[model samples]
Target chain A: MRSRALALPMAAVLALSACTGALSDTGSLLGRDTLRIGVKADQPGLGLRGPSGEFTGFDVDVALDIAERLGVEPADVEFVEVTSAEREEALREGRVDMVVATYSITPARKTEVTFAGPYYVAHQDILVRADERSIDDVRDLAGRRLCQGEGSNSATRVIGERGVAARLIEAPTYSECVTMLEEGEVDAVSTDDLILAGFLLRSRDAFRIVNAPFTDEKYGVGVAEGDLSGCEAVNRAITDMYQDGTAEALLRMWFGDTGLDLVTSVPQFEGCS
Target chain B: MTAEAPPRPDRPTARSRAAERARRAAGRTTVRVWTLTAACLVGIAVLFAVTTGAIAQARDGFQVIGHGAGPKVAATADLYFALSDMDAQVANVLLMGDEHDLGAGREEALRRYEQRRDDADSALLHAAQLAEGDDAEQENVRAVLDGLGDYEQLVAEARLLNDEAGGGAGQPPAAVVDRYREATDLMRLELLPKAYNLTLESGATVRATYEDRRSATRLGPVWVALSGAAAAGALIALQLYLSARFRRRYNPALVVATAGVVGLVGLATLMLDDQAQQLRTAKEDGLDSVLALSRARAISTNMNADQSRWLLDPERADTYAQGFLEDAQTVLYVEDAAGEVPGDLAGYGAEVDDAVTERGGYRGRMLGFLGEEVRDAPLAGQAAAQQEVLRAYDGFLRADRDMRLIAESGREREAVSAHMGGAGSVEDAFDRYEEALIELTDLHRDTFDEAVRAGDDGAAGWDVLLPAACLAFAVLVLAGVRPRLAEYR
Candidate 1:
């Protein structure tokens, strides 16, 4: 009688496991040899798609390293361009196995899709023209035209929580924002320092970051909800990426020239549900 | 006679009085004939002035629309083509990368780019001259010039950066790509649009002139006929009155004048009819074809540039790919055709070609540059020339498909090699297509020139003949009436 009762619970657990595995976006990715990871195409050093028809930068390297850890070859990894707005939808629709597109881990986002790691803790900073000196801190952005990238909430952080009454000017991408800033159309560009660092690499002396960071934007790898196994797998990969010094090397290679305090350690991972 | 009037003391005799009355009546008849003849002469002169003025105006209308603004607008289309080609060459040079000795070589590409720049500059100067009177056109020209300056600056920056960071074929530095993106964006968004607008503005002028002038010429015959009839009727009335009052069968001079007026009216009507026909031919066949073909050439050139951009910038490969398809459709469109791949072009071209030749199954349905060309193939050899152009364009589309397939199959280097290959390259195919288009344009241009010439020829000698005929008619009328008046004396 006890043996029969034990078998019933085991069968129930097995069925539940099967159901989770089938529904999990990350679980499906684990089974496949080829993995499609969403990334940013326009960012210069973070996840830029280069002229060689290849994706290059810090995020790309991390994605490849994670894929390698997941037993998928680098060649088997396909990078799809994903913007801030489409990250969650891309994961839910199975358009991407996971998005390493500078996605931030937030409580609201965690409700929609599971997040793997904080992989890199980026600070929100302000970018302005090199010659401009009147405004330095985030507070000084008041009444100035601040470029807001489409689908990015960086503009809200300045005006909403910070109470800065800065005027928001929208652009399709951060690259376009930089373009606007270069042409004097926008007074400043506010985003993650890493993204700004990428733009600074190309412009040389045309722009500079204010270094006054406010808000800790913990970049995360997003997976479909209920994909606990997949999320755990990604977490393990993130840990390996840091322990093996691959993360540090990638960060240094892409953002070394840009004057930012490079974080060289594993970030605090958001626990998988 | 003695019973008629028993004379008063003042009257000498009844016969003498009757003779006086008869002489007064004859003198009055001569005066009436002279007055009517003078009035007929004035009416003939009026007809001469109106008919001659209409002919001269028709001739001038043909010159202005057919030769002046019409050709100038077509020349601005060359400017559009040149600007597109300049960007294409820039992309080509960048695609060459560290490999300076490709099929055409970077040096040759740069040289072509410079040549196109010069051509564009000259075209701009010509456009400015054409847009002299209209403030809006002048402003558009100025805007294009400013945008061109910005575009050139960005291109120079891209080239400098690419040269500094020399890499393999089809792999430019990130910074170079960024600069090129800016430059190409500005060219596409600002300069090209403004240049096309210049053409559009000038084309509008030609169209307005054509409508106004053609309408005038169309009604010229009717007005000339009405006035001529009035003049002829007056002459006939004068002749009838003379015959009745003077008891003569005919006045030879007056009869000749009436025949001259009728003949002049008939000739003027025929000339005016011919002028209207010439104007229609010039506008519908000549200028219309030139504009459409110019647009086609420019669009095709830009489409080829999109191919190079696709090969060079892989990040936006799909975007460029989409652009290529859209441009292809613009050049030669087929309904419900989703040209996702290069192979799809052949079917689309075939469908369009079938519609072009059948002219019945799908007549008026096929739409685009090539569609319009086939629809209105009015010239002697124009239909055959349009078919040749379609064939050449099909060849180019095929080559483009092959290149794109190679690129898509992960053989980018081979694709680039094939693209830069001299003989069987996309560029070569496009050049042949351009050749065919030019030939067609030349045929239409000839027609335009010929129509204008015919318009001038039709109105020839009317200016002097009209006044001379009027003078002759007047003298004939006076001569016929002078004898009657001399009878009174």
Candidate 2:
């Protein structure tokens, strides 16, 4: 009797243990459906929203293509607006399926999420007023003020470097930084050259970006870590895009004549740290 | 021993000894049952707590994933975009310095150059505001800005001299242009890298954030499984003790306790499985999609901005425009294509067609503007044509209203036509392309936003559900164990 009584619960516990294996087959949890992404709203030629409220830019086009390859229809994929500080948390907590808002790949970020493909390469630079005097080299503005977007790496680089002592002003976006410069609230703005070019184009007569790159930045797509299959898939898509003419066509469509040497060759996976 | 046996004849020793043994066994059974019950209850409670915690964490992780990806992505995107623009501006200023005449056109170029500089200044300020890194980058940018101001003053003086010479019709004053070129070259080669370094540093931080999120997502399920296993183990032990104590095969309370443990474990396992899957999908599919989009966009934007800046400098405008096109075609197009054409290849094809048409029209305008000068020396003509092309392009670009109209209508063909019409002057083409590119960028932004919203919707409510489930499972397990304890009493 004692053995029989023990047997029942023991069997049940074993049965429950067996069910644990069911947890291992996690495939069904991700239903077959479209994934939504969030990107920048105002970046020119990259992720700008049209007056008709249609999303179209180099980034948007690439993201759509990725969705289609994932079996998501064009109408199925949605978009959300996100700023600089919000991208990582969003991806970690599952707010968005993906983020294509000019994210870069780096060793530090590899700790949190998986990344795939350097779809585009960029660098940082400085912009100054066309007629401004007394500022030319990085060392020339030692005691002056500089503007950058809040939560931007540019701000940290500027603030962290040795032998430089400039007041830092923060803004939410590159455009706002331009406004600050226009309003004389800061001395200089540091960010990616492409964005500054947009500002210069818009301002027409108010600013010019210094024609030298301060750093190399390669933009990558971010996903939750250990999603090797998804990472591989995205990597493949990007690689395919590079080989085909689609990337070029999109580039021409968005950036009429910006001089960026987009690399056509596939990028090798330098394992993420 | 024989004497003792004789004495025990009246005592019934064997039967008494057997009975005492039975009673002691029964007492031991009772104690074991009570102890087992208590252990089971405690195990169940811990399991519940752990499961609940895991669920809660999973949910929180999901929310963080869903909500946090945007800003970091945006910051990096903006940084790249700004840097690309600054590079173009620097290049343009240098090219402008090569011109012998600082006439109205040259002055206009200078003004545009100044504006680009201003924009760069603003971008730095914006970067600083974000506080992503240390303070040194801000200082470096400031120093560069200051140096650029000094250079600008020198360039302005040179411009004055050239302008004066142009008005007087004497030997062209090339000295000022030379000085301006020298200053620009110095800044471009030296100070610019400081800013680039800053961007690189920030990129590191953004990448780190991505990694942190990835690990958290992956670890969530393991926690749940462990907790569930622990709970199940305790319940089984309790059931064994209860069975021994009562000599009964069926213990309803023990059975209930076992069932509750199973249920809790099962629920936790399922929830964990689901959460893991979602996180995996996000990691695998989502990150790269975002990166590719951003890279393509950044490159494209850089190309557009550079093209426009080239138009501002007529003398070397064609060279710059050609350079811009080459870069765009190579980086933005072929690289982004990867391999097979996307489903929406038509849109890309249309865009390419429009670009080609625009380029052709720009070439024709350059030829027209150059007239005889272009014919005298083909190389000179090419140079002259490039300058003329740029001017026509600028004119086209500046006509924002027409470009906006074409963009609003989604009439790629019409837009191309309008762009060609405006390409009679470099200035014209510049205006049209600028408007067109801006419109295209806007469209992409909307598309990205929609994708984000969909992702968010799919992942919602996990945070609250996880903790609640854990807590409930614990309560059920404890309740089931309580009846077994009462039976012991």
Candidate 3:
């Protein structure tokens, strides 16, 4: 009787256990031979979808490098589309094995998901139409209709703390805001300088960065929360890529011809510390 | 009177008496038949008039309310939003500099702007469709469309000049600002006023629909009542004549026919009453809200243009500033002929007043940054320029509180970055002040969309419901009179 009673409880416990999926643990990426990465599909040089339905961008290159570090082949890595708002949720829900979509590293975000190396620093800058002369700098943007990517704090910080009098419009993605600027829907689009440069590369002679950069944004790889081992592994890959001149090579390959501020060395890692 | 007496039965002369009796019976039959025919014919005529008149009234009402008022109001709102959206897009395009051939984000902005232009085009088409036959209305809509295209071209020219002047330069040339000013002036003085006039014309159209609906319903009941009363009077007269001639209590056929006419009159009146009341409610709540919201939106757009003009033309800064104040007064306060504040908004009204004062404080600070001697003329008799320069420098010195004290300040990029939010820079501070003014404009805009939506919802199903009611009354009149006509048969 006791054995039968124990069997019933055991079956019940087993059923409960079967219903719950496991969280991604530290260094667990290697267990699966194929890696799934969430990337921005619209950021031109950072992470973008090209013709022939292929993903190509600097962020794609970095993800390929990290996958190679994990002993996974570049062809085996699948890229999932992630928007700015969905990045954190996508990581928590196991929608992606990792993310390398020009994700910014922040101390507050560290509490939700672990960040690996900050491979790049993109300063906050403004993108205006080719014909705008009233706005020479951030100050000239006063009362202008300036659009920013939704969920980005670049415009918010300027409006909140700096007191820039710009009229802020939020779009779902950087691409939409960029389109608005190109068509003259909004006055300026403000975000990372390098991201804007990527836009400039895509749209010829229609736009340029007007004012100097205002804030520094460090880009990092996003992993599951508390996955320190996975974060560390990605950081190691970044470090090796830098040491072997591969990181600089990729940077030159993607942005050397553009007006972006190119860097030869890897950015100082945020370390998730 | 009893003039002749009949002969006795079963006599040879009784044949003559039989003939006289037969002739008298025939005469009585003829009288009864003619009276019944007259009553029935009059009843049928009145019923026909009531049904056809009601139907005609409903048709006219529906044509005005459904095809004219409803769609025209929607068209006006679309035009207003489209113009406002286009103006904002122009500003946005100017802000994003030369984002072609390699620029990503600004190009996205350009696409968004094109989408807005498409929206405006669609709105124009819709307005044209609403006003299909009227030459004046069509001409007016075309004017707005042409004006919009011109405005876009001007904006493009401005963008081109601004891009050429950029050339990786430190500041944009004065010519760039001038081009932007021209574009803005086109929007404000020419394009915006045309849009406003279109809205007013649409408002007039909307008013006509309501007036037509009201007048249509008003006359319908009176005609129904008048025709009904005449039919009843004819039937009653027939009844009295029949009662006297035949010595009967009442004619059942004529009574039923009279009651049918009365029923039709009541039904038409009731239906008309419901229609008029509902139509009135829709007009007051729905159409009035649209008018108020349109006015509010025009004010906000005007303010936006004024602000842009102020930044683009330093020489006309004071003029633009005064214009902003006047527009702000109109937007914030509901004034009468003498410019007296009428507290129509109750508690929500205070926000405008507060925003105005807040804007004033920021404007004072910003005008100084723009080198307003009136604002930044720090107490100096012979040294106004010296004191103002010293004060500006001091403000910058205190600006970068947490920033590192310039480790060999030769890097132009880093120095600019470090001084972005610095104290004495006053750049960000000016932005803060401008933000408040924008907030003031936003407060007015937020309520406009809701008003339009509420008005639209309230006005729904009016045309169908009213016409359906009229048809129902017609059926009720036909049903009530059919039984009376059958009794006559």
Candidate 4:
């Protein structure tokens, strides 16, 4: 009788313990049947949620391609929505095995996540209402409310390094910022030309990019900081994607009709090892 | 819970014996009732603490969102942008020789320069006000403000030297170059770094406040609710147990206590639920907008620096050529590459032919981000601005080719002349392109506030309601329990 009573308490303790998962200090990205790849669900061309609840975007395509290269079936790659602010957290928490969002590789970010292959290089540019003609260049930015998204240091470079006297506004996503611009809440939205093109193509609004890109941004795949093998594998996939005519094909497939400079040339890859 | 023992005459009869047993049972039940009462009070106290703590956290989070992340970050972004623009204006002045000699052009550049400088001053003032207390931010702003005065004097001296040199077709005197170089160095290394530091500090502050708001302890609500429910359940069971044991239909005090405890549990749950909802909305919607603006400003600032570098270092001709080419190709998707400049102008003609052949499409821009002779690129004319960019770039590339030819013949002076000369010069072509870029940059600047408005709007309703909800929770518990305590009395 006593043994049974103790067994009940032990089972209760076991039940409570089940609530706490293993305390993993870093991502233990072992081989699994399904790989959870985090991406932006709101960034239209890079990562977007479709009507069918499936994700579609350049990042999604890239992630799919990488999965194929990893010997994992494309159908097995699970997509998770990750925002700019949550990228590091998601990786650290092991909520996703890899991040294929339009992740920019920077030294500061390297502290939290390892990056693989800068598969594409994007330049910083501005988007304005189609009829807006008074603003055309970076120099004309004084006294304007520029909308940019959070969690990355993309906007400060323009204001801090360039010395444009502009007001700064923040948004959670590029799409929402575009909505603000459309609503006349903000005068302009600025980001990578590639991202802006995605917005323009999907927005169905009269928005145009002011053919002036100022900074070079190298887009890389992000993995948890300690996951060296995963980072290396991602880099390999990117290189293969470029070599096998896949990257060019993908760009044309998604961005060919957008009037964006769809140069199919693979971007310079950053160091992997 | 407390009850008096009734006076009983000893008898074996049913009535007297029953009364005596009932009294004994009531005395024991009183002790159990008091224990439950203490347990209920402990649960309520814990609930009070949890809810109140959450309220304080919400208050702090709201304050930081309102005061620190709100206007302060926006002002800092402006301050940083203005300082860089001012530096660019100075570069423009340097690029234009003898501000008084160029008729209408002179006046226009001077007017724009002065206006830009004024904007910088105003932005600095605004940033200082925003950064009033923080030692690091203040220090950085002060350094930039102080450095600007000296930078202006150096620019003036350089302009004077260039004017005295008759803004010659040939390279200006070494002294003039030295003066300009000094000014550029000061802006690049000293003033700009300080401005960037100020921006970094501001960004850090905003992120810190955001993290604090997001990192609020949730331990309070979940635990409090659990304890509260358990306490209420215990109170109800105690009331039922006492009524059955004492042979009474109901103990009014115990009944009231049980109801009061249950009500307190509901109120606590309600309060926490409200807080949780508000916190989620604030983070997802409001703070996100602030972060977006921060990114746009940083990118623009970096691009501005690249533009300045193109003009500041004319000596590194090939480097500038390649940098400009890559920057153009990356954005405009222009398929043009700077062919190898021959050893001593021997291969200049061949290089020109190669460029002309490559200029038609994406075949000219580097492929594989590293490969040469990239091909099969997209066409231009997506937007009017885009067309304008292509035109300016085409004009500049042609001009750059001419400069290359001049540079090759070993006539370094003639090359320098073509490099920085007026009208159709490499410098002039780039100026046009940069003008377009500035216009684009200006358009985005005005959007910084509106981007985050929706998020801010969602968060605005969160701040004032949290404390009131918590207070309501406490009040509801008090009103429900007070009558029960009086029944005990």
Local error of candidate 2 at residue A46 (angstroms) = 39
* Fnat of each prediction, in sequence: 0.00, 0.00, 0.00, 0.00
For every candidate, what is the interface RMSD in angstroms? Answer: 36.3, 17.3, 32.9, 15.9
Where model 1 places Cα greater than 4 Å from the true spot, the runs are: A1-273, B1-17, B336-364
Q: Where does candidate 3 stray beyond 4 Å?
A: A1-273, B1-29, B32-36, B67-69, B96-112, B130-137, B167-171, B251-254, B329-351, B354-489
Q: What is the DockQ of each candidate?
A: 0.01, 0.02, 0.01, 0.02
Candidate 2 lDDT by residue in tens digits, A54-135: 7766778888877776678889988877666688887777777777878876544555666766666556667777666777
The regions of model 4 sitting more than 4 angstroms off are A1-273, B1-21, B27-42, B98-108, B111-142, B163-174, B217-313, B316-489
Per residue, candidate 1 scores C-alpha lDDT tens digits across B1-489 of 111334357845878778767766766676677668777877788788779778877887877876677778888878989999999999988888889887778888999999999999988988999889866567667877888889899999898899899888877788888899989878875677667656655665676577567666766776677678767877888889988987899999989999999999999999999999988888888888888888889888999899889898887674566567656765776653342212233445566556555555653245567765776565789878987887787788778878878887998777887788789988788889899999998998899889888988888888788889889998888898888777766
TM-score of candidate 3 against the unseen true structure: 0.43
lDDT of 1 at B249: 97
- Superposed on all Cα atoms, model 1 deviates from the true structure by an RMSD in Å of 27.2
Q: What CA RMSD would candidate 2 show?
A: 23.1
lDDT agreement with native, every candidate: 0.79, 0.52, 0.59, 0.59
Model 1 CA lDDT for position A124: 82
